[model samples]
Target: MIALCTPSVWAQIKNSEHPITGYAPVNGLKMYYEIHGAGKPLILLHGSHATAATTFGGILPELKKHYKVIAVEMQGHGHTADINRPISCSAMAEDVSAFIKFLKLEKVDILGYSMGSGVALNLAVRHPDQVGKMVLLSPVYKATGIQPAYWPMLPQITPEVFKGSPVKLAYDSVAPNPKNWPVLVDKLKTLYSQNFDWDQKKIGAIKSPVMVIVGDADMVKPEHAVELFRLFGGGQFGDLQGLPNSELAVLPSTGHVGLLFRTDWLLAMIQPFLNKQTN
Candidate 1:
């Protein structure tokens, strides 16, 4: 079961005391983003139904100390407000790309969790030039990448299921039109239920270095994560050829929602990878 981290809880624990928050008009939607710290850019994408604060609140202080963290709220999620378009990963990626252009940032690192991981993947694939390095946490590269049991549960995630839940509460608290709760839920259901997968060849063609992080008990299967790692030139015998540009980490005793909350563990893995010089 995914643990809910409400905004109220985040405010208390978030390390970064303050952030420069704003909305960027991109792809017909006012995409909300928060900038923290200074230095190299690091774009953060939150999972489905999660706000930026809820996803990365715990790690903001540490992350910001090393890079300029840009946390974005995708369409229909968090402060971005719902839009008329479909909530597919590709569409969200395009919005992120536009947001990057709007900010005039050249080559930035990106880290995404769950649904956001898919968006980060699409962004790196479609606009390779903009992405420097990537960190995908519990990403779903293909429909089958998700565990079999999770597939059946997707259709059952209707608007009614979210009533009184943290996700709904979070949405109601910040959404411009709180009454449009049903609309956002229904759109997310559509996004979750859709059968979508990126082409493996195209994914393999991506040049930017990547780090694939997954929890042992995550919704995404471990073997599938390994497959994704291999597609990016990882999983080879490192002792013989030296480590590949890509890397993978399967955190023990962790689940999807718990993955982001493990800030120290994530930073330990992520910082080293990001600090490495890219050839």
Candidate 2:
């Protein structure tokens, strides 16, 4: 299932309404989203550094096969309203949860990538009934298998200080909130330096069906995917350890950003996963 999705490659979302749709979503930002198909609602959350447009690209088309996909771009990214305040995983998660409820959706299949996965976790944990099924792709280190609430507070940095990091330079080129600049850079660095311990006790609280996917080379690493997959099904050291019905998909030679453009393989696997649920 490992295939190349070059940057030049593109996918046109046919049947998409003009300019997509925007709503006065939670967090007081105009969240951007587009709806397609005519079935169970599936919420797609993009990575922090990317917009929904760039992350899903081609997969949205195929997902429409059996799902009414609602791909949403979070605040400070893509077509969503911009904000200058500090950004945190909990802040974004609250915004996402509010949007889902504001829309009056009975339940939704949720898929989150990278930083967005943190938001998804918060949603599933706090509003478990709203989530029918969940998928986390290379979730941030803390959100995947750590105690999301136990995140260690760190010193926030400015973009100038973040510029010293190589990863920051590569991220700033298409930065969604250029206004936040150094604030964002410093925040990400701090977030990465210390991973919240999402232990089995915390994960045991999640009762929804879950699937964890990862590119073998993902920045979060394969071991993380295994831990998440195990947690979703109950971990070896936990009460529900060895719980069934969870799966982990590993795509070799793929990383965080690379997986975003690699829609072919993503659709091939994700389509079947969601299909099994709705059917």
Candidate 3:
């Protein structure tokens, strides 16, 4: 299970709120998003069944300081309304790409956690020209990247399983139609239950640099994280040859959910990588 962090930072972010919020008409659904601060665009995608607030609340304050943070609420999540279409990473990536174009952003950095990470990866692979860099937190690129034990649990995540939980409560608070919670849950269940094994050739062909972050105890196995890093031209012994453009960080004592809560730790690692000048 993902660990929850202290509520102070979350409260602060919610109370202050994003200065700008709007819905971008993309691929039939009006995708909701919030804009904070201003600089190089950095699109943030939340995990399954989560709002941008739920996933990035703790770190948004710091992240916005350096980026024109665009925190997106994917279809059927948060303020975004439900649609008739099925939810999948590839489809969501397309929506995001269109949203970026709608905003006239030439190229932007992308960051995502869990399910959102899948979408971010797809975005980089499918629309390489639209992406500058990528950060994948607690992500699994392929079906086998996830632990075997976790596969069986996907089908078990029904609406009833999330009743009264923070995820449900968050949805109820911000969803355009609060009663559609069950429908959102059902769609997420279907999305998560299906197996996703992206083409390795496509992943290796991504031109943008990437940063892969995972908890040592995350749902995604550590070795899989290393393998993904390697795919991105990272994980090399850089004693003589300089480090690769791609990077990896396995936070100690962190879990899937807890990984997002470590704002200070994440900032320290993420800032330097983002600030570095690309050769």
Candidate 4:
């Protein structure tokens, strides 16, 4: 059955507005990304589990109409998908920074979803000069501490871990496991997820406009998202945009998956915000 995506979403992909492309980040990591329109450059970062295709699939077309959109597939996921992936989220953030430099692009727009948001936040926090505008979709901020549930993903050298194809199996399970929250949490812990601290102070250090968003029914604790918003220094536009210009959009009855996939709802929440950026 064909999915019912918002007309704008479908139009972006259909009208050949956004063209899928790839980039070889450091270590020959062939990262996948897509580009659309020709205005201010915008980079799209997808969340965990699936590839960029899954997260940015709907917003591509619509966004293409406004700014230059670039969707990237982080290592071990999507086009960069591979097992025994050499790095964690922090490393992935570094890879993104390298990609931007290799492209010879000084500054651009960024929209991050779920895990992608974390990666984007890391870049903004660490490499401020690389990004102009930032959007944190269901952002994950470890300001207080790591979630107990993510303990499994913490680094652990298990003899049996590298056995067969641990990486592929890990990616394969992202979908089915998402059905049950607890089970998913357990799986993440087992994956040896790293607990990297996100310094809220660094967020304030970011010299760019920022937007934070989350669905009221989002599964990932909303507080985490709020922490990210507040980290931006929330003054107004141009000042980090932690909480002020960093408007939080929460759709009632929308779960994490719904927020990421709901074309109309996502457009309603993000379109205006994005429009205001670099417009």
Regions of model 3 farther than 4 Å from truth: 1-18
Give the per-residue lDDT of model 1 (tens digit) for 10-96.
Answer: 655444367778999998999988888889899999888777767777677688889989999999887888888778899999999
Question: By descending TM-score, how would the candidates be arranged?
Answer: 3, 1, 2, 4
**Distance from true location, Cα of 14 in model 2, Å:** 5.7
For candidate 4, give the lDDT of residue 91: 70
For model 1, the superposed segments whose C-alpha errors exceed 4 Å read 1-5, 12-17, 192-194
lDDT per residue, candidate 3, 131-211, as tens digits? Answer: 998888987778778878787887787878877677777777778898887788778776754467798889988878889
Candidate 2 clashes between residue pairs 3 or more apart in a chain or in different chains: 145-198, 146-197, 146-198, 147-197, 147-198, 158-182, 159-182
Q: Report the poorest 10 consecutive residues by lDDT, candidate 1.
A: 10-19
Candidate 2 lDDT for residue 20: 43
Model 2 earns a TM-score of 0.76
C-alpha TM-scores of all predictions: 0.93, 0.76, 0.94, 0.72
Residue pairs clashing, model 3 = none
Per-residue alpha-carbon lDDT of candidate 4 for residues 224-252, written as tens digits (9 for 90 to 100): 66655556544345545433555665567
lDDT of each: 0.84, 0.65, 0.84, 0.62
Clashing residue pairs in all predictions, respectively, total 0, 7, 0, 9
Instruction: Give lDDT for model 4.
Output: 0.62
